[model samples]
Target chain A: MTEVLRVHEPGLFTTIQDTGRLHAIASGVPPGGAMDRFAHSAANLIVGNDRSAATLECTLTGPGLLIEAPCLVAVTGADFDLRVNGAPAPAWIAISLRAGDELAFAGRRSGARAYLAVAGGVLGDRWLGSMSTNVMAARGGMHGRPLATGDVIAAGQSAMAAVTGRGLARQLRPRYDEHTLHLVAGPHISRLGADARAALFSSAFVVSPDSNRMGYRLEGPGLETSGEELLSFGLVAGALQLPSSGQPILLMADHQTAGGYPVVATVVSASMAVAAQLAPGDEVRFAETSIETALQMRAVQREALESLTS
Target chain B: MPPQRSTVKVRIHPLGDTALLAELGTRLDTAVNTRSIALASALKKRRDVRQAVAGAASVTVQFDPDQVTHVALAAAIRRLASKRPPMEEPGRLHRIPVVYDGPDLQAVASALGLSQQKVVEIHSRPIYRAFLIGFVPGWAYLGPLPDELVLPRRPDPRRQVPAGSVAIAGHQTGIYPLNSPGGWHLIGRTSVRLFLPDSDPPSLFRAGDRVKFFPIAE
Candidate 1:
């Protein structure tokens, strides 16, 4: 391992993440990782690293870093104003940097999160077989917290020479502005009012400011449920639960292991990356879909990603 | 412990493309919780599944869509759910001591129209089962509180509850493993640590575990 960069300024909520800690979920630990999985992998692939390599997941804003070694880096996910050595740089493509090169994000031009990956996967403390940070649990990735100023990042030295000139195709780059997500009916669909589907589909919902990696609380028409109060039950990312207020909360990467609210629908995995891109005040619409269609969408997404990694 | 239902109607529904939810009735029944844990345990051991987390009455099974489709995984889950789980390995039993001197203990007793000592007696009388481990790492949901002691969560939640604070709400009680915002009524505090980040498992309680709390002078 070699020191790669030092944080000059750690902007809004930057953390090191990989695909996340999947096996630890059974132990009540959340799969805390890149909110946008596709972007995370794309960033890593562009830098000629393993797709599951840990990278910096900068939320809303990004950090300023001073490069200390010859390295290849790429940024993906939310669009941001990236600069290198005080010069403008493009995102989603590999860029070569040497000692003394400065990298920084001025602000988010669009989108809510971004990924910065360097070759030889950024090193972090391994927890549950992954380096993704679990802030609440206070483990993994910069001591289970966001990167702060003065922190030095170490990266495993890759034997392959640093590669550049790789970029994701325009069509393959996910569009976050669509704001439309597909969903499938949940098990507790029966508990909802008859117009629940219509209410969910027809009404325009806005992502509440109280959103985070845990879940997005949507503000819209109150979905009425007819039965007695429900008990706590296991939930996963993408569960669209209707609370007493009728508004729905879409679970995300860091969502609780269980909740008691009635679930009306679950957003498909294909649309999760899109959901992760949304920021507070973004208009989000839901399209009802079937399981078959959901899987097909997911397959298509996976195929697009494979083209990059392979 | 609540008695098991004669029949538990389990339905496997798609939580999304990547996860499946297996529902096992709705109430806070220990039997249903046990089954949920069992199903989760079995599914977690398989290579196909990414992981499985058991809730009070459900198990959310997560998997990779590229490797297996919802239909195939659902079928496997159905087959697994149908089989009565192998003789269960009993979960670890914990005997936690709590000093019943929380700020809300007196208020709770007055609200329930009982003496402070009587309220403490009722709260400590029953053996509670760990239905799930959630709401934060190591913060367990141990419950089916004695009916007399059951009360709604406080209307206003505190911004930060002290770690190790033993609290109660609707139908359950739990000790705060970490300092966090909470709405439950605090009734006591404990010295036992529920979470150890340095430890492999971290969490002290797992689903299907038994929790018995007793009064302590400290």
Candidate 2:
């Protein structure tokens, strides 16, 4: 075990996360993990770690760390202006660091969250076989909460030597400029009348400030429902639930197990990467796609990622 | 078990690319929920399915795309849906004690056109079944409340309901396992600890369990 680094300044909401808890949702716990799976995996791949390796998910701002070991590290996701020893450093590439080096992320260039991965992956407290922190349950990660100042984290054994100066291919990088998240029509999409359906595509909805990891409540057309709230049903990430108030809630990684709101549509899994970069006021639109097309997009993205990591 | 109704067919829908939701019924009924739980339990035993969570009237299976295709899984679910739901073994009954003083007790009783004491008696009389555990971790949806006690949720939800706050809404009753924002009408408070994160099985209540509440002098 390698003592990785000590936190000097914890940013807005930095937390250790892997792919999330898959086995625990049956007990009403959601699979909470890095909001952007593509970026999380890319950051891990740059550091010679597997896709599910634990990484620091920094939101808005990032942490200031005092490096305790000579190792390779990588940063991905939101463009946080990374600095090492008071000098500017590039992101999406493995950077070699010396013991006692000062690594900090101060200002955000773009995007809402970022992922920082170490050569051997950061080790943290695990619950239900995942290190992803569920703050609501106070389970997993650094005492089951966001990283705070003066916390020292350990690094697991490096599988292999990650070559320094390695950079992610430009083609594989996510384009955050486009705010449209493509979705597939859900079972209850018909419940959202044609007028509301047209409005969903035509109007750009503003992401409400009340949005968080749980879900994003969108400010858009008041979708009228034909019937009363149906019996509560299982929910998944990216499901767009339309409540009686007319606003749609785009369920995210930390959404509840089930809810009674009528789900009009579900955002395609590949589009979740773009959704992760959105902030409170970011304008978002949704377009409907076929399930077959959604699967094809995922396959294409999977191939692109494989070409990079392989 | 009631006779299987051939009139309504199970509706299976895609939840993005990762999950498939099988909706058996639109209304919240014990028979429908039992079918949901049975279907979820069956799907959980499969190697391809990662997690199978049961809701009040549906079962959602999050499966591995590499291991199984949605088309193939949907077909599998179709086969499983046709089969009769497994006979439910008797669930463990939890007898809980409650303090009858809550902020909404008076309002709930008044809205139901019943005395506060009468409302409490109707609520505690029946042995409620846990249809599902949902909304939040360890919060079980216990239900089949007497018609006399049924009421709509509060017009506005509380921002921070204390843990162990026993509340009701519609035909269901639940205890808040954690401090959370809820719209349920608070009828009483319970001291029972419903969630334990450090324990191997973190949740104290499981889906399909039986719950009965009793009043105690504050």
Candidate 3:
């Protein structure tokens, strides 16, 4: 019989995500996906699933899941107090789940989001070649939204044998408490006055409570621009846009495809996972780095992930 | 005489390690938009480009840094700009039927010093072109409005403009595919759905498509 997982209680915000929906920006679709991609891929690896396997991205709180068939599962990201059949369970490692086994979370210990990957991966309709859900657009994933109570999701047939006792190394796990994000100068960086630019690099920005998947609104120094009217242009995730209000907003996975706000800088790809783990009231500082150094950091991160696979 | 090709200078800037922004011009003009669209089409065919999104007056190319460096990618785009790619073929034309009975209709007409009927006629007469798709999914920025119909956006934007609201701001006009808070002056509303996620391609119109709005009686 095919294994199926049923949601008893869909916690705060649980959505299915993969790598992302690539090449859909032409239609104004944001590349929505798992915010902490490193953790998402690591969870899949622990369960012996492919790197791009569809997994559950649980935000803040997690769901109560009832397994209908035997399967292997792993929970990674946002160290949550996890339990199975009301007994304490370990995180960041694959464990065998039997029929009628109930998995639940007590509370989150750290981080803002967590990833749950099951062996053989989760099955969902692929839109634009991706299963990632863009909640704002109500497109892709299961019913184009977050999972609800009583929703039954099927598990794909496993190709590789389930490898038990697999877990990520301690050092490989990302430290969610690290709040300093490395950035590279953006296209419109020169438009700002030297004083405004200095304020950006010197001040610590507190993540606002209004932030969501679209962006992280930071409350810090108000950056002043040259008051030039900027033509609307394509925007990439991680671009730090400074609107007329002077507040900087870091674009995230569900950000608009195009924007008119002047972008002062972009968070480096290597620190995107760190940005994703930040929660409300968290303080963050920015450090500017050369594009060459940013690329090198990304290479190091990719090499680290590759080592896990090997 | 054959139409002269645009010679606008294209400026390339690194967005980050993975993307590059190619600015064709600073203003919103047909020549600048045409160049952006053409360059985007050219870049889309390159293996190094993961995605090429054209905007009002710029094109952003997202590429894999591992596959191609930013410097190499920028050089290729500069070469394409200099050579000038062929203009994009026009997309399917759509005639959208709208009811000219929005709350801001009178306000827009008075602001433009034109009668309400005259505003509707001018808005419906021209076959506008889709400049770019952004701000929202399937929301096409259609433009080159008849000079007499142009007006600035409302000083205070509406808290929420209902979906299917046909609105205008500056030299452009568009239909709201989904209900959203907007600053555009609403002149009408349409029943046609501009976006259907389940449908193949999803959007009813693509960039470079022609759109004509016709007024319907309530």
Top candidate, metric TM-score = 2
Specify the highest-lDDT model's number: 2
Between candidates 1 and 3, name the one with more favorable DockQ. Answer: 3
Q: Write the per-residue lDDT of candidate 1 for residues B108-197, one digit (tens) a residue.
A: 999999998998898888888999887677878889998898899898999999999999999899998888899999999999999877
Looking at model 2, the pairs that clash are: none
Model 3 vs. true fold: TM: 0.95
Candidate 1 lDDT tens digits, A1-310: 9899999999988999998876666566787888899899888888888888999999987899999998899999998889998899999899999999999998787889999998999999988778998888778988888999999999987755666878888788777778999999887888876697678888789989999999999998888887877777777888998877787899999887777888889998889989999999999999999888988887777777788766
lDDT of 2 by residue, B1-218 (tens): 57663443778898888888888887778888888888898999999998898888889888988789888998988778778877898788999999989899999999999999998999999999888887788889889888888888888999999999999999889999999999999989999998888775678888889998999997
Each model's lDDT comes to 0.86, 0.87, 0.86
Per-residue CA lDDT of model 3 for A62-100, tens digit only, reads: 999999999999998888899999999998888999989
lDDT of 3 at A95: 91
Model 1 per-residue lDDT at A68 = 93
User: What is the alpha-carbon interface RMSD for each candidate?
Assistant: 1.5, 1.2, 1.2
What does each candidate score in C-alpha RMSD? 2.8, 1.9, 2.0
**What C-alpha lDDT, on a 0 to 100 scale, does residue A308 get in candidate 1?**
71
- The DockQ of predicted model 1 stands at 0.66
